[model samples]
Target: MACSIMVTAKQFFGDPITCITDEIPQKVMDTYCWIQSTFTLPHQLDRVAGEEVAHDGVGSYVDGQHEKKYHKYYQWVVFMLFFQAMCFYVPHYLWKIWESNRVRNLVSDLNNPILEDEKKTKQLKSLTMYLKDNFRFHKWYAARFFICEMLNFVNVVVQIWLVDRFLDYEFSNYGTEVLSFTEMDSEYRTDPMTRIFPKVTKCIFHKYGASGSIQTFDSLCILPLNIINEKIYIILWFWYMFLAVVTGFSIIYRCILCSSPQFRLQTLRMRNRIVDFHILESVFNHGDIGDWFLFLLLARNIDQLTYRQLIEQLDVSITKKTDRESFTISMDNERESKDEVGMLKIEKVDDFKKF
Candidate 1:
């Protein structure tokens, strides 16, 4: 933002040096030059040469300064860049909120060992149902994430249009000409004055109200500010292009990760290993692949685990009922053996007494 504002400031302060004139009277020239330097006007004049030139207000100079028009627009562009950055962050914030409110509580309940078996079983069933519902919410969150990237791409393209609109057709075509693969040569790249930003241009100045006649002057003027504008836009053009490519790739990668079942399964397996190995949470916490997406994938895996546990519990209950009579008979046989051993010991004692 400061860089952008600095470019505009250079243009504003340097507008006076944009035009130069010869052959005009020193008094008239000084007055005109003062006006140009002192005030921001709707139009400006270029250098002119003639034997006798009429004196008019400085407003009768060359074309209006393009930089004046561009300053406000550039500021707005910088502001929008900040706004888009914030937009990208909003989804992450919302995901954190959802995790705190919904996910943490479920995990705490499921991990508690002191709960009755029946209660734990019920909680598992409930957690599975809850996760299925949250999966739909994850889809929505993922959509928002992709939308942010799309907006970033759109912003870059819009900024390009804004550059063209304010800077004119010559600057608008700069990207195509400069970035063209075949057009770049050593001469074109090295010559900043002529190739990057042209400084020389024809300027017209009109002098009014001297002897009720208007005097016009035309000459070549050197625009120093064009150099600054040219350099700024060139860098911006490349920056926007880089931004567009990265955002495009991000969108594509995210789509592939979400849509492919195999990828989701692979992520789930990796997540399980992470949990089992007691890995650092930071490994998954601070990456482009967001924590919320990982959480959703893990939720699906937990749902599967819940179903498996329920099935095993049902199998235990059914088998226990069928084996009840066998278990009772084994217990009775052990008791009978103990009683017989005790009765033999008592008989030995009675025989000794009779002897």
Candidate 2:
């Protein structure tokens, strides 16, 4: 009963200390405390960062008037780069995973009428013939499959290099404890503070517009600087793995989402048309009939021939729907008397947004 009350108090007021009352169950409180301690990153990170102002001190390599800059500039640059890589890129891949899941649901809900469109199939054949006469499928596949795939691979390699560089530099300044001993020795032995006494007052730069001046020349050493103790390697390993998995999942899931049953049927019809017209075999000499069929299948809006050309070449009447709000199209036979006319009512929903 006390454990429940303590948990309730913490849940209501947002303080874990409430869970520590003597009335509470010891086991429950212990578990809660352990969880809280394990999951949170160190709050000491920022405090240690402020104290280890390597560039602020007088004896530091870059702090002298002749040096013209802070020694910490390089460290800051590296830290910022790594922060961006971890914060921005990791979330980016996670967001892609979420997007893929959403798109997959959207595709599953879309509607298609290919099952009822015999006239549409006939009209598709005519459209295919016209495409054969006009466009070469081989050229498109050469660029899309060969060129784009190679570029994507190169981009992945470049991303890995940049991320590795950022990580390496960001963590280097952590192991600088030996500098503190050197600074202490230089301050006492090298200079006589008695005779040439400039003002002995220590003024600290308050970068945040506060009145407190920083002890710029203070020799500070960062404690527990080892990233291994922090389990950063495990975190980074999981982060990179998640990124790769999400990227691959996004590509597959996006394809599935955009190609709803209706979209898949449309693709199949396009492929069948390409095959019937002999465009797949003639234009793309490198690809087999099946390969060209798939290429045209996945490609959107691939009607390389006009309605007039389709009619003249294949004796079919293909008509597009007039509604701009919908992506629907239709095809019919002008001469053949059939009660069932082919009417396609395609809608460009959210699933197809990426494509």
Candidate 3:
């Protein structure tokens, strides 16, 4: 937002374009050229200034003979910057809605170390119970958050490409060309900034003569705005590339960490040394992918000591629950075995009577 505001202030409040003309009123010519847009002669930029073209990108628009590269998006630069800024928040917004406050409910105010002991213990127990009961139900919840992260990576990539398109495919090489320009001999070098964003261009205004014949007026226009534009884009080009690389790598690492349980276990241990390794492994083994993901999130949000206690409590609760289930299944099997023995004895007695 700040970036957009700055660009907007300089581009609009300042005179974006100035035209030299005696035939047309100065203000009228400036506004007309700015609104209608201006074009540069691409072929003339390479020619020697004094011997060929009078100035860089300066020459005749004779019968529209020269290949023209119109300065199209200078007027829309701020709006584009604003759009880019807004796109970055889209994933965050989706996650906010998708999250549904599940994390908040689980984390509660437990992270606050100054809480009353009784209230804190009560909340901790409640959190443990919730995790114990809700196991295996939150796969989509954790997965959805990761999907939003993937969207964030995608957003970065899209904005990079969008800027390239906005600059007529010049943005991809803008930074590189600028950096390498000094290596070339001065006689052979052309400024990439000027090529992508020209300070001077031409605009044609048409009118009718007193005799009613069509008359054409050509004007040489100066754009001081491109100075600001070149600097802004060079900074942005490097920023976007760096951001893209980091975000992309982060997404790949997350995908690998989530896919491999060993990596997840190692990460948990690395983050929380107080938690028992055996407990972590036991709970992690029994739980599905989503459970570990949510647990990891809780570890980040909750206070360290509290999180250790919470993990211990969860381990105890799961252990008891599993033991009860095992006992019930064993008792049922024993009862079935006794019933089978009784049925066999009854059948023996009936066979003995028949004999």
Candidate 4:
């Protein structure tokens, strides 16, 4: 947000660019530079100013299409920064809304379990029952947070690509080119920052003359703001790339924990070894992915003593539920077997009667 405010002020409140000339009006030439943009003659950068080149990177660009680089990102940078800030905010907003004080409400007074004996017991039991009732239904809750991590990675990658296109593909290698500064000769060591954000560039303005003919005026423009731009973007380029790598690793870690039951069990055991091992195994076997995510979250928020008690209660309830289901299935199979035997007996009796 601060970045957005700063850029908006720089772009709208005043001009960061100034073009000097006597052939055309100052106001018209400044406006032309803002709209039409300025370009650098890269080959002219090597020539001395005032002798061969009028200004650094300010000379002929005709028939040198490959050598000329246009500065088109000046006006759009503010909007781009503003959009990036918005993209980051979206995940935060969604997490807050979806979470909606769940952890707070669940933890409630348990956060400080130093309550009176009866109050502690009551609060602990209430949390246990709530978890027991909703064991396999937290898939969305867990997925929402995981998705937030993924969105962070996606946003960084997309913003990088977008900025690359915004800066005429120069941004894709901006960091790499900056790193190779040591290899270049001292006599011709033009900073990659300068190439991307040049100090001086050329813009041409056209108008009608008194003789009913078009008049052309070439303006040499100075960008005092590119100094700040170069500094900001170089830092941002490295930071965003690092963030992408870290987030990608985070996603991989989550996948490993979720997909590998042994890994999840080990993590749980490390969190609270005092809990009965068989109870943990039973709870794990009876639940889905969402249930496992919620258990991990619970382990982090509550004390080990309270968590152990809660898991014990859940194990009791889930074990009974699973047993009832298994029993019902076995009875159903038995009933089906009896029906098949009865049909076979009936068929045999009919065949004997016909004989």
**What TM-score does candidate 1 get on C-alpha atoms?**
0.46
Each prediction's TM-score against the native?
Answer: 0.46, 0.29, 0.91, 0.84
| Tens-place lDDT digits, model 2, residues 1-355 | 2222322343343432222224335455444433432111122112222355211222223233332211122223325435545544443464454335432332221223332356555545644544443333334433343333343434444555554454443322222322343466542432211111111111122122246654222222221111121234334435555555665665564356334534434454454453443432223442333333334433323333332233233222111212321342222344233333322112344336646
Per-residue lDDT for 164-187 in model 1, tens only?
A: 665444445576676563566643
For model 3, the stretches where C-alpha displacement exceeds 4 angstroms are 10-13, 48-54, 335-355
lDDT of 4 by residue, 126-196 (tens): 88788778877888898899888788888888888988888888888899889987788866776788778
- Per-residue lDDT value at 173 in model 2: 26
Instruction: Choose 1 or 3, whichever is better by lDDT.
Output: 3
Please name the candidate that would achieve the greatest lDDT relative to the true structure.
3
lDDT of each: 0.50, 0.34, 0.88, 0.82
Question: Regarding TM-score, does 1 or 3 come out ahead?
Answer: 3
Evaluated against the true structure, the overall lDDT of model 3 is: 0.88
Q: How much does candidate 4 score in TM-score? A: 0.84
Off by over 4 Å in 4: 11-14, 48-55, 60-67, 113-117, 323-355
Off by over 4 Å in 1: 10-17, 22-135, 170-196, 219-221, 267-273, 276-355
- With candidate 2 superimposed using the best TM-score fit, by how many Å does residue 14's alpha carbon deviate from the native? 15
Lowest lDDT sum, 10 consecutive residues, model 2, at 192-201
Indicate the TM-score of model 2.
Answer: 0.29
lDDT of 3 by residue, 95-165 (tens): 99998888888788898879999999999999989989988888898889889889988998888899999
